[model samples]
Target: MTMTMTMTRSLTGAMAAELTSLRDRVLDAAVVCVDRGGLGRISLEDVAAQASVARATIYRHFPGGRDQLIREAVDREVGRFWRDLAVSVRHLDGIEARLVAGLVEARARLEGHALLQRLLRQEPGDIVSVLAESGPAVYEVLATYLEDLLSIERLRDGVDRREAAEYLARLVVSHISVPGGWDLGDEPAVRRLVRRQFLAGVIDGIEPDR
Candidate 1:
């Protein structure tokens, strides 16, 4: 019975791994389609063809159809951006430095991203609407990363790290979405804004001398 149970568990794990790999392949195919012919030109059929999978197989993985697949692809892209940002700021000493570096990197990344530029140019409203719908989830991702940075820097005192992270994340997103009067293009200005507006309260209880 124990051996039988172990074999079952192993099989289940293998199936899960395969499913994950298949999903990634589908998403990669979707990304390729988007890159090749912008967001508005792609369809589930296109994705399936590009992925070399049947339409039914694509639907099996993404039950919500094309929109769901697009959302997941965007999420994966955002996750990759954050991972790259994390690496960019990994060696920075303090949370404040990291925050400044992160914001700068994020702005640069967004401005320079080819896929995002294409989407913005060809299907601006669709991408903007999708981003609005995904705003909370994006904030949560940023806040979670901020929490890790705070913990690592040993600066998670006094302030509610999660709340502070959310606030800071919103601030970053707002700047990205609409510069309004702020010149987000200037790294020095962005750093000053991050330090004065966000990090000040985040490290509120830390001693000035420290």
Candidate 2:
């Protein structure tokens, strides 16, 4: 009985891991398909073919089939975007450096994604809805991530960590999507943006540089 129970637990864990793997692969394939041809043009069959899995297998992993696959694909990409953004700035020395690098990285990723650009151009509502759905959760993540500011000396006087984080998160999202003057691709321009606009509001020291 004991041996049987142990084997059963092992099998269960293995099955769970396999399912997670399948989900990840399917999500990746769906994103590729969406990028190649907008959401309206792709179906579960296309995703399955891209993933090298059967339609039935996709359905087994995603019970709602195409709809669930598409939605989860969008969510997964959003999560990936944030994770990539975090990793891009992790090795930097200071908050300002990290912030500037993060801005450039984020703009590149956001603008470089073909699916998102296509959606924005042709099916604006779909992408907007996904962003709106993910916004609050992402804000919480950003707020928690920015808690590092509490220990830093440059944080502006009388600013709470949460408030500062929220402010910065909002600004980053908006500016990345619609950066008016600053060239996010240029390091100096992004550095000036960090010092002039972002850090100026949240950090005490201000250096006038152009």
Clashing pairs in 2: none
Candidate 2 residue-wise lDDT at 49:
95
Error of 2 at 77 (Å): 1.2
lDDT of each: 0.82, 0.82
Summarize candidate 2's per-residue lDDT along 114-183 as a digit string, tens digits: 7688799987877688678878888888777776743564676787777887877887888788879878
TM-score of each: 0.85, 0.85
Predicted candidate 1 versus true structure: per-residue lDDT over 23-54, tens digit per residue: 99999999999899877778998999999999
lDDT of 1: 0.82
**lDDT score, residue 78, model 2?**
82
Model 1 per-residue lDDT at 179: 70
Q: After superposition, how far is residue 142 of candidate 2 from its true place, in Å?
A: 1.9
The lowest-lDDT stretch of 10 consecutive residues in candidate 2 is 147-156
